[model samples]
Target: MIKAVFIDFYGTVVYEDGEVIQKVSQEIFVSGKVNDKSEIGSYWWNEFQTAFNNAYGDSFKAQRILEYKSLEKTIKHFKSSADAVKLSNLMFRHWIEPPIFEESKQFFELCPVPIYVLSNIDRADVLQAIKYHGLKPAGVFTSEDAKSYKPRKELFEFALNNVGLSAGEVLHIGDSLSSDIKGASSVGINAIWVNRNNREIPSGVTAVKNLIEIFDTKYFLHE
Candidate 1:
């Protein structure tokens, strides 16, 4: 008897075009003499993710800034730390502007359940994405608000507490097995991994190839 559903933002609901990689590459690593936009873009993207996670994990801007500066130096084929910061912000903005999946849009309209967004983004960006895509959900939760990140049960518990629902009554959906699935399960919530890469399903978690599959709520309800 699931009463609620929580979905992840970036890869789960929407995804950026591969052009985002080219943008970051030309701006950052390419100017610095790095080879291969795809490889460089992948490196910077990983660094960007690490910066945010370290920021949220430690619950302080100072440490995260320091971490970002360090990564800036590490990737210094092009510019200084200050410039790197600007490049990172630019890349981040592009990264969040994912094209909404048309099937997800229609599926959300017909799904007969409470829906929410849970992400490791700031409130402002979450709001921006929600509005930009005309998404309507019962609520939005972010790691910035939680003062921590997913894969840490406390963050999931915080969202659960806010919604006033027991873990059993809610379903958590996201793309990351380590974060979304493990974090949700730690709090006793059922999790579904939105496996975009056709990866093997980790043990003890349900999964789907796309958000549209969740329309068949019956399949998950019995799990």
Candidate 2:
């Protein structure tokens, strides 16, 4: 039986408004120069992934730092405004808090099991999000706490260890197919992907569309 639920933060509990950033960033920079916002987004994501992966072993780069570096690079590389650093600083301030999902708020209230947030965010920002949303989970764990990130079993193990529960006793739920589902499974935890975008349910992986679906008696309780 599952004793606790571990959920991801960003895409699961809260959703980031990327469009807001895109519009604002473009306004701050040269729109004529940065023709495709999606292109810049993809480039920023690639830089973040590279930094995150490189920091896995010993180096520890905070999410905010990565954001600054990525945004800085994107701005300069595109030959936008000369004030790239200033623009990114403005963006980073806005990036700290994300809007909480309505379904996630309801899940926190309705779920019978103890729930915790396990995310790959810096400690301060994670705590800020929790407070801003008024979330009262059993606990909050982040990359800052683990000194590593998701898609790595070590972080999953850290959450399991902190909860003092065996992998079998906990259920991990998140939006990422690779990080949440695979990482939790790597340590024997049952995981469900929160596929809100109607993605295909890959073989060997269980999924739910909304957070409430898992609580549906007819759908998941029988399992």
Candidate 3:
């Protein structure tokens, strides 16, 4: 049986509003040749992951700084007349204040135990999202605190230790098959893949289409 529930913030709990980002990008990168302004937003996100993948603990950088740098590079490559710094600022601000998934909100409202956030994000950004969404988690922990990102065990251990629970006692739920499912399970915590995209689940991985599906599953209700 689960004693505590650990949720991931981005993609799992809320999504960065793509439409908003797309709209902002069009205003900034207004050009006759560019028919797909949304590519700017897409490139920004792709560069966001590229930045994270290139990040390191010994040479740590804040998420905001990385976002700005990555987006600036992306904008330059695309030859947009927009101010890369300004566009990056707008993108990061929109990211910090994201739309909370209604199903995630309802799940948080009804989860059986205290909920805490276990995310790969800057503390400030995650906290802001939590506050804006009124998530009111029992606690929030992140890579900025752990000095490492998930799929790495240190972050998970840090969260478990703070909550005073063994890995076996907590249930971790998130969207990534690699980071959320494998990461938690590797550390002995049971995990449910919040597969919002209906991706194919690998053998032995627990999955749900969304948080609402968790309430219907025996996994959440039973041991």
Best by TM-score: 2
* Residue-wise C-alpha lDDT for candidate 3, range 1-223, written one tens digit per residue: 7789888888899984566667657754674235576676677778877777666678667777787787677667677666766666676676679887878778888887899998887898888888888777889999888877787787899999998999888889988888888888889988989887778889998888888888777656664
Error of 1 at 22 (Å): 4.4
What's the lDDT for candidate 2? Answer: 0.79
For model 1, what is the C-alpha lDDT against the true structure?
Answer: 0.71
Tell me which of candidates 1 and 2 scores higher on TM-score. 2
Model 3 spans > 4 angstroms off: 20-47
Please give the CA lDDT of all the candidate structures. Answer: 0.71, 0.79, 0.79
Order of quality (TM-score): 2, 3, 1
Candidate 2 local lDDT, 1-223, one digit each (tens): 7789999988888886465567656653554377665677677678878987776657877877877787677776766664656666555554467777778888999878889889887878778878888889999888878878898887888888999999988989999988888888889989888988998899978888988888863334855
Residue pairs with colliding backbones in model 3 are none
Model 2 ranges with Cα > 4 A deviation:
24-35, 82-86, 89-96, 217-223
Quote the lDDT for 190 in model 1. Answer: 88
Residue range with the least summed lDDT across 10 consecutive positions in model 2: 23-32
lDDT of 1 at 150: 75
Q: Write down the TM-score for model 3.
A: 0.84
Q: How big is the positional error of residue 207 in model 3, measured in Å on the Cα after superposition?
A: 1.5
51-86 per-residue lDDT for model 1 (tens digits)? 656665455343235435645754674452336666
